[model samples]
Target: MDSNLYRLFGDRVRELRETRSVTQEELARRVQLSRASITNIEKGRQRVLLHQLIEIADALDAKPSELMPSPQSQSDPTMRRDVARVVEMLKSEKSRSDK
Candidate 1:
């Protein structure tokens, strides 16, 4: 799939975020992400993982379904369940790619 699909998820993220009147820093703190990351997602520059989406939703008193692409449609099944592992792998991949 094209990255645009992830961009589509960004609007939902921004909506649930602003609906609660929470600051980006607060949301990022709750999710263990950087404010820049929250900005990126809200601006359609990065796609958040399922866990982060759920955390953000909870912080905003919303549902994960309220912040995600679709309840039935997700990024990847296994990666969705184990975000830490996937994040580490992605970091490793990035390091390797950057070399």
Candidate 2:
């Protein structure tokens, strides 16, 4: 699979997850995946099966296609930054919860 495609998909997942205020751990639990697996999916380091994609989308109250980035949006730097921001926000939330 192409790295760029992976990135695009990952970003879309992260964005939707964040919009729904779902943490990685919660999503993982709902989807019956490990936290690491959720992290890998969001980081674009691991590929997801179609069934898993459907599960994730459902957990986030979204359609499967909503978890995908369009080719035009994939190349958009603003979209990447937005995803990065969501990651940072998640990290901050994690740290707060840990404390």
> In lDDT terms, which candidate is top?
2
RMSD of 2: 12.1
Estimate the overall C-alpha local distance difference test score of candidate 1.
0.68
Q: What's model 2's overall lDDT?
A: 0.77
Top candidate, metric TM-score: 2
Candidate 1's TM-score: 0.62
For model 1, the stretches where C-alpha displacement exceeds 4 angstroms are 69-99
User: How well is each residue in 1-99 modelled by candidate 2, as lDDT tens digits?
Assistant: 468777678888899989999999999999999999888999989898766776787799876667767747665656645644554555456559879
TM-score of each: 0.62, 0.71
lDDT of 1 by residue, 1-99 (tens): 547546756777777778778889988998889999988988778866655665676678875545545534555645334543454455456559879
RMSD in Å for all candidates: 8.7, 12.1
- For model 2 the local lDDT of residue 74 reads 61
